[model samples]
Target: MKYNMLLIIFPLVMVGCSFSTSTESLTDEIITPDIEKIEDVGSEMITHHHMYDNMDRGNHDYVDKTLVIDPNESEIFRGDVVFFINEDGEKDLSRVVALPNETIKISNSQIFINDKKLDTFYGKAHRVGLDKDSYFKMMDKEGNDYDKEVMKKVFDYNLKEKKLAENEYYVISDDWLRGNMKVLNRETVIGKVIGYTK
Candidate 1:
């Protein structure tokens, strides 16, 4: 019975001893305002927000799994990670690369906003040779399984020039070569990713 009690109490005693090692040491360790910095940066984000952007050989994969999302914060901006659903009611995620009231044009394998050519690596778009312009038109209107109007809008904007509405935001990944970048509605957004776990 004594050996069993020692076995059980050993861990407890060690824990107690460590905590009471010295009042001065405990005070010294607690003096720094590390919690304040933590609070300032907001609580630790644990939600697994969406991840993407890396692509090769006509395929893509999500890059990170530890993304943190701030659902209550809805102020969207360029480069903000936005999560939403598509016309087929499929949940998806992408970054806000262009804002509303902006003109987005893709031509010559490069993206141009408001007639100013984007000079970043993200401007280079790549995708399978698909006639996305007609992909939406081919869908049935009365009994289609996709959002015809929204899909048509996105598809048309991919090949032609488009001016985003006040409630629209353009989203795309770092692999900007794809032709199906989303010009998503503001109401479709779920939240913004603020940070990621280490």
Candidate 2:
């Protein structure tokens, strides 16, 4: 029993240690080619990985094709899903919500950064209309009313509008209640998603 226990715990400890020591390695003025190399970001730190079933990073069970983050890459832009360490000292991955010094607001789950409405597809300016097919496809998978449940909403609060510090970034995973968009200091960011494995 003791031996079996050691076998189970050893890998977890190794993974954790490796994650803690991992550093981002990319030169400044990086040029990302199509289909860069990637590795499994690991699943243990994720909460509700199921929410991203259709996306690449959503598959926490194994490596889904994902981009490698390069802290030295320079020019962090809106909509990049960054792999970063969180305040708790655990490694995590979330979508970049806002760049440094940008003021942002959240209304009914729609994010407005610098007074421009931002959409989930890498913080692009949201289109004027909804994509009916997108919602319907989500419904087809989860059953009736699942689409309504997936709608993003954040409670209105006095501090709804916020600006990121110079070394901070905003990231979101599924945009639900608890795991909605958040700001991660520049120190936490490892690299932007560059590409996934084939």
- TM per prediction: 0.52, 0.52
Candidate 1 lDDT by residue in tens digits, 1-198: 999999999999999988853322101121111111122335534355344443221333334445556778757766565667678896666656568999877765556677666554345453322244444444543455865555444433444888999999888754444323768999987776555543
After superposition on all C-alphas, the RMSD of every candidate to the true structure, in Å, is 24.4, 21.5
C-alpha positional error of residue 182 in candidate 1 after TM-score superposition, expressed in Å: 2.1
The candidate scoring highest on lDDT is 1
Q: Quote model 2's TM-score.
A: 0.52
**Regions of candidate 1 where Cα sits further than 4 Å from its true position:** 1-46, 49-64, 126-158, 176-180
Tell me model 2's lDDT, rounded to 2 decimals: 0.52
Candidate 1 yields a Cα-based lDDT of 0.56
Backbone clash numbers for all candidates listed: 4, 12
